[model samples]
Target: MMSGFCRTPFKYQIMKKITLILVTLFVFGCKPTEKAVETKLNYQSQVAVKGDWQVTDVSYANSDYIKVSLFDLGNTKCFVNSTWHFISNNNKGSMKINDYSCAYESDITWYINQNNEMVIKFLNGTKSKKVTTGYVVQYVPINENKFQLIEQADVLNKTQDIVLTFERI
Candidate 1:
């Protein structure tokens, strides 16, 4: 005895509710499962690092680029490099990064050692002898296209606290 217009909207509402509920359950109830295979490099023993990644951020000297390359160093460590180059229009100057190796000059290193603990070291070129330790916080994958590396920077007088977020390229 109901009009077609009334029934159509009522059915649409019901369908929407069910769809919303299903989406919520799927998103909240199911968490990403870590791959069963153990990785040789256990940077964070508790969490598995993503096997595939893309560059999310790059800043070198006066130039910045989003293209980066992540390379596996031995023992769950990694080396990231920038692959972007361009000419600056303002000064009519050329600027770009041709390398991405992180050494004492680059204040960044992350690794999961045999001890089953994650360690991050932020270095300054001047203080090559001393490395202040920071909490080896687990990074969260923001989405399919982004990786978030969050940690407190070094405790040195010149260090700046930072929360670095990178997008997978």
Candidate 2:
């Protein structure tokens, strides 16, 4: 099988190789360059925090991570009777703590602070005053309906780990 004059030998082979390389480059360049982390950042920034949330568990993320259930804290009645309603499209919310009979219902104005934490501006029965320093919150959402909120005593200080989980009601 020796052809003295093969039309598609050196020139055709080089052309085929260049075509393959160009196709590969084009395909790769056209693909999306966005990453999951960057996408998450963009998604989280615009996440909605307006809804009814309940404190499901409050644990300690220290050397010994302990999960404290609402009942275990001996505040089942208070926690169960409580209602947290966050005003939509705004940073205002209310926390009502009361008994089953609604004997002591207290609503408070809450706002999303600069650290993405819930700042209780004023309580219903307490000294009506906007708190300058507020608590820190780390909202870790699993999906649209389900999420976990990690609350902290201090936001500026990272020495403490997240120790709270709130669920949507």
Per-model TM against the reference: 0.28, 0.44
Candidate 1 root-mean-square deviation in Å: 19.1
lDDT (tens digit, per residue) of candidate 1 on 12-125? 999999999999999988978853322234433223432333334423222232222222211111223322111212111111222344431234444454533334444434
Residue clash pairs of candidate 1: 43-112, 56-167, 81-100
lDDT of each: 0.39, 0.50
TM-score of 1: 0.28
Off by over 4 Å in 1: 1-49, 58-135, 155-160
* Tens digit of per-residue lDDT, candidate 2, span 114-166: 34444444354554454443343555656666555554433234444444455
For candidate 2, the per-residue lDDT at 105 reads 44
